[model samples]
Target: MKSLSILITTVTFYLISSMYSYAQQTTDQIKDQQFTEAKETIIQDEREALKVEVEEINNRLQNGSISKTEADTLKNKAAEKHAKNIENRLIILKNTLELADRNGDQEKESKTGIYVGWDEDANDFVIKTSVKRKKEKKEVYDFRTKTGVYLTWGLLDLVDDDNSYGNTDVSVGRSTSFEVGISQTTRVFKKSNFLRIKYGLGFEWNKLTPRDNTYLVDNNGINTMEQFPSELRKSEVRFTNIVIPVYFELGPSKKIESQNYIRFSTQKQFKIGFGGYGGLNIETMQKLKYREDGRKVKQKIKRDYNTTDFVYGVGAYVGYGSFSLFAKYELSPLFENQPIDKNLLSLGFRLDFD
Candidate 1:
């Protein structure tokens, strides 16, 4: 407690002495003293800037962006640069001080590291900093991967096992395929964005409408297409699937880089992707509409119908910016066991928003 009281008494006397010293100064005398002390402040500021530069270079070295030798060289160059700045600025400040002492008056204007001077044109006293540190801007958009939702619709055509395209059973205009999902695209390389990997999860729909008055008949465990005894207005089979699609995309992007960050943009850029999708069939449903006993009747049935449970397909797309021409062909057989083995193919337009 006695030591604390002694410290308080000492501080009180120091404050009184400082106030007395401040009282003795005229405006011109105070300005001269302040101008002289600014030399030390400038030197200290340059040294501090040099330290910050060294720390930044060390960070690059630790991150493997620069080698140790390069970091050392950068550090040395920064030190030399600050040293030279200190020398040159001190010489100028010393010359100005000597001129002021010889003239026995404060200078109206003088070039120093930090300057407080009278501006004749502006008719005012101005302060200026000769040394300035560069500031880099942070990018507003900065990501290697982009995510968005996608929707697709297309015409579906069935192909027989022996035939590459076309089937006699399903109508081309009546059959349709659709997909909706979330998607992501990522850059494949550290320094290049020309190549990317795109992947997504989606729900798939495949619909087939039979031609003529024929309907699917399940006899025991065997299924076949047969004519219905009753007149039929519509007969169709719909398949729902959950799928994961992946693609290797090739494209060009606009790159903007600085000391702060690197950003890649695909705005108005053309891109092409080739990939495949695979997943399990969720469910299959059959719908029939016909006249029974002179009254309209509709029937719905849910069954596997020996259809393949595993759904897989190859897909390709070419586009500019947000829209693309897309095509996909199903590789798995339509049925696990059937008289005619068939596959499905679809072509349509797609939109991706990111």
Candidate 2:
């Protein structure tokens, strides 16, 4: 188990790093273009202002409030003023660009608490306000809850009881589990976001395929496996549960602090969570496929197989970004009355889109 966990950790981190590196380097090559576009905008705006100033000077000359010489002087002064304004503003803009991070994360929280960052995905400027100012007072908002949807799927099998000598009756390779749900993460500390309470509601599906052409048989009240009479193409038992999995997630996040708001982001970072899940077994079903009298036949069996109704398990995960290596083990017995007790065990992957 330790070796397997280490392998999963290494592989998951490697994959996440590769993906993030590729994405971070894939720029639109639009930063330089933004400079040109901004320069053009400045020139156009100054020219328009210059034109208006010149018209006003002409109007003054027509009214005889100023002579041609005076009007020309005024127009020249206005033109020169606008030219200097353009030069100065352009310099400021250039300096701002220089201050930006070279890696294209040019998002800034300006000194004046105002920001206009380029949104590459939106192809527009994303303007943000820091705090609301009223007279001499400012109101700042700090929110602590973040929510996201998670999807998980992985290997599933049953762990034989320590007291029992029976072997596993299901094929580990053929068994699988899947879960999908919404999660809400809240900072556990007032000043630090390193520790968080992550909880969610998920719908889980666990399927186990019996080994050696065996099918689940309810011998009176006890659920047992029996060899299929015909050539068994497939034999599987599936359980669906509505579970609530809660985990205490610990991770470091980069702080995106502004004058008005502060946020901690764990995107593309390392995190580990240890928690458990408890829920009710909503449904149980079995599927069978075989050939009978030269005809293919399929059967869907739904009956009480003495399966546990309430299910609970402990789980842990460690990963970077959205992907994680997830492992879980159930404490409750799978069947109520059985010769050998079997506990459900699973090792899989989880993706939390938080």
Candidate 3:
């Protein structure tokens, strides 16, 4: 009876030891698998975050908001993150190889997944997995009118030696003029938006101040400059016009593409344009501000003054950036049926804004 009890106790002890060892081994296997899965998940999440960051940096570069050097720095950081991602993947492979060696699992060694290795040229790790990406579709925009506003202030003068407005009495310095305009630009070519036709409406004011105390006078449908009576401080002839201008503008342009639209980029360098304009005179006036009878006085007279009711001109511009050199010469005479035939000319610069 004693031998039987002892034998039963030893059997129970051996079974308990075997069961405990099996449970512990199972728990260890579960832990290792969970650890590997958690690591893979972390690596994947990190790689996705790096991809998002890299895209943002690339956007800044294309938008011209960041310098090339800054972009390169960001790109290097992204590469480093990519290298780290590869390293994490390789670590899983290395652990699998070791686990296979300890367990004597030849199949795991033979059929291992995701072969990752070092790439010396790239200074990073390379994955042997191949992934195919879908090609990006391009979105094109319909032709539309692009508009801009410009402000111009420049010198105004009369051209032609015979029509020099009564022998340089019209001081060029005092003939400063101003113009404001709105322009609509249309692309002339579908493939190349660099060539464009621009047409717009503008308001111009030209002031011609005469020297030697001279002022303009109208007599019998004729315009002439006469000496101002009394000690005149200043005298000027002013004309206002509403003009329509057409131009063939040419320049180098870049395409700016968004997700849903594409358009030509704005370029401010090395632009050339030739155009013509026609307009109607809105107002013509002469002003004389002088001291009479030892008192301050002013005279403003509005008149036909034989000035041309309609005017047309050809002009050209060459520019770098917003500042441009511009020249315009009128085809029509300054006055209609005048005693002297004169033509208007102007040279100036314009500041453009979108």
| CA lDDT, every model vs. true structure | 0.75, 0.77, 0.71
Best by lDDT: 2
Higher TM-score: candidate 2 or 3?
2
- Residue lDDT tens for model 2, 101-172: 343343333433544466557443444445544454363435788899998988888878452212478788
Q: Which candidate order results from sorting by TM-score in descending order?
A: 2, 3, 1
> Where in model 3 is the C-alpha error above 4 Å?
1-138, 163-167
Q: Write the per-residue lDDT of candidate 3 for residues 1-354, one digit (tens) a residue.
A: 353245334433443343343334434533455434444454555555656676787789889999989986876666566555545454554454445345443223235344444344643333454344446667768565788998678777765665463356678877977889998888888767778887889998988887788888777777777887777887988999899989898888777777977788656557888999999998999888899778999889998777788989998898876678888778888789965577777888977775
Name model 2 segments beyond 4 Å from true: 1-141, 162-167
Global lDDT of model 3: 0.71
Ranking of candidates on lDDT, top first: 2, 1, 3
Which pairs of residues clash in candidate 1, taking residues 3 or more apart in a chain or in different chains?
Answer: none
Against the hidden reference, what TM-scores do the models get? 0.59, 0.61, 0.59
Question: In candidate 3, which residue pairs get closer than 3 Å at backbone N, Cα or C atoms, i.e. clash?
Answer: none
RMSD of each: 19.4, 23.6, 17.7
Question: Which residue pairs clash within candidate 2?
Answer: none
